[model samples]
Target chain A: GAGVSQSPRYKVAKRGQDVALRCDPISGHVSLFWYQQALGQGPEFLTYFQNEAQLDKSGLPSDRFFAERPEGSVSTLKIQRTQQEDSAVYLCASSLVATYNEQFFGPGTRLTVL
Target chain B: AQSVTQPDIHITVSEGASLELRCNYSYGATPYLFWYVQSPGQGLQLLLKYFSGDTLVQGIKGFEAEFKRSQSSFNLRKPSVHWSDAAEYFCAVIEYGNKLVFGAGTILRVKS
Candidate 1:
């Protein structure tokens, strides 16, 4: 079976440009999550979705970061006006249950703001 | 705030040597603990998890972790490591919002 997948494995953008990252979760996965991993650091939670509902977005850094999982199978993370600080790898994960389940992660999209 | 800690930033061991990576969490009760491995330019791979019962849990790739409630620790151990095991290891815990809080990670360097 296929695991979680993300698009645009690498992205390069100029400062102030907008960027969007896509994630395709595993089939029938009810829970999805997004994380950001900075260079030489552990990944930090960004947001979570259960089905089509955006249950938690507390980890989103600022108003510029927005995520949507309209149909519950695919999710997107968008950033308005990219900055150098936003240069990092964005990771997506999915699980069979809502919580306490093993999260299968995608390869992630590395965004580089030049 | 809840957090996970990996005391060692890096560890270098010869092939076939025993290995242990420490992990500690700050939480009121026992939370779901997990160990994950990530190779360069790859996503995290679940090694094992400890939910309940059985303090010692075996994971894939010949890895095991022991959870100690009294110590608030879940340390990963391997009897003999292989050269291919060189990668980054992370300790994570499911916090209040069902999101994982990860530690700074430990880089394992296996010398053959």
Candidate 2:
């Protein structure tokens, strides 16, 4: 079986540019999550989705951040007007249930804003 | 605010030696605890989880974790570590909203 997969394994964006990171969750995974990891630090929760519903976005840092899982199988995290502080590895994870299950992860997308 | 703490930032042990990584968490209720491993440039891999009904839960790759409700801890341990086991380990607790709050991670360095 395939695991979660993310696109643009590495992305470099100029300051004030916009960037979008994509995540393809495992088949039938009802719960999806996004996290951000700064250098030398642990990952921090960003947002969560249950199927097509964006249930939790509290961890989103600011108004520039947005996420969507329109079809429940795939999700995207978009950062508008990216800043240098937004530079980090964007990680995506999925689980069989909506929550409290073993999460399967994807190879993250490393975003660098210069 | 809920938080998890991995006391050891790094640990070095000889191959085949037993290992323990301490983790403490702060939450309001019975929390869902988890341990995950991540290799360099890779995403997190679930090692094990403690949902209920068993203080000691076994996980993949010869890893296990013991959850102590009184101590507010879920420490991960492996009896005999292999060189390949060297990686970053994280302890996390599930928040009420179903999102995970991770610890500062412990880096394991195995010396053969």
Best by TM-score: 1
Residue-level lDDT tens digits of model 2 in A1-114: 999999989999999999999999999999999999998888999999999999889899999999999998999999999999999999999999976777888989999999
**For model 2 chain A, where is the 10-residue window of minimal lDDT?**
A98-107
Candidate 2 per-residue lDDT, tens place, B1-97, comes to 8999999999999999999999999987889999999999999999999989989999999999999999999999999999999999999988874
- Top DockQ model: 1
Q: For every model shown, what is its TM-score relative to the native structure?
A: 0.99, 0.97
What would the per-residue lDDT of candidate 1 be over residues A39-62, giving only the tens digit for each residue? 999999999999999999999999
Model 2 misplaced regions, further than 4 Å: none
DockQ of 1: 0.83
Candidate 1 regions with alpha-carbon error over 4 angstroms:
none
Candidate 1 C-alpha lDDT tens digits along B1-112? 7899999999999999999999999988768999999999999999999999999999999999999989999999999999999999999999874799999999999998
* Every model's DockQ: 0.83, 0.78
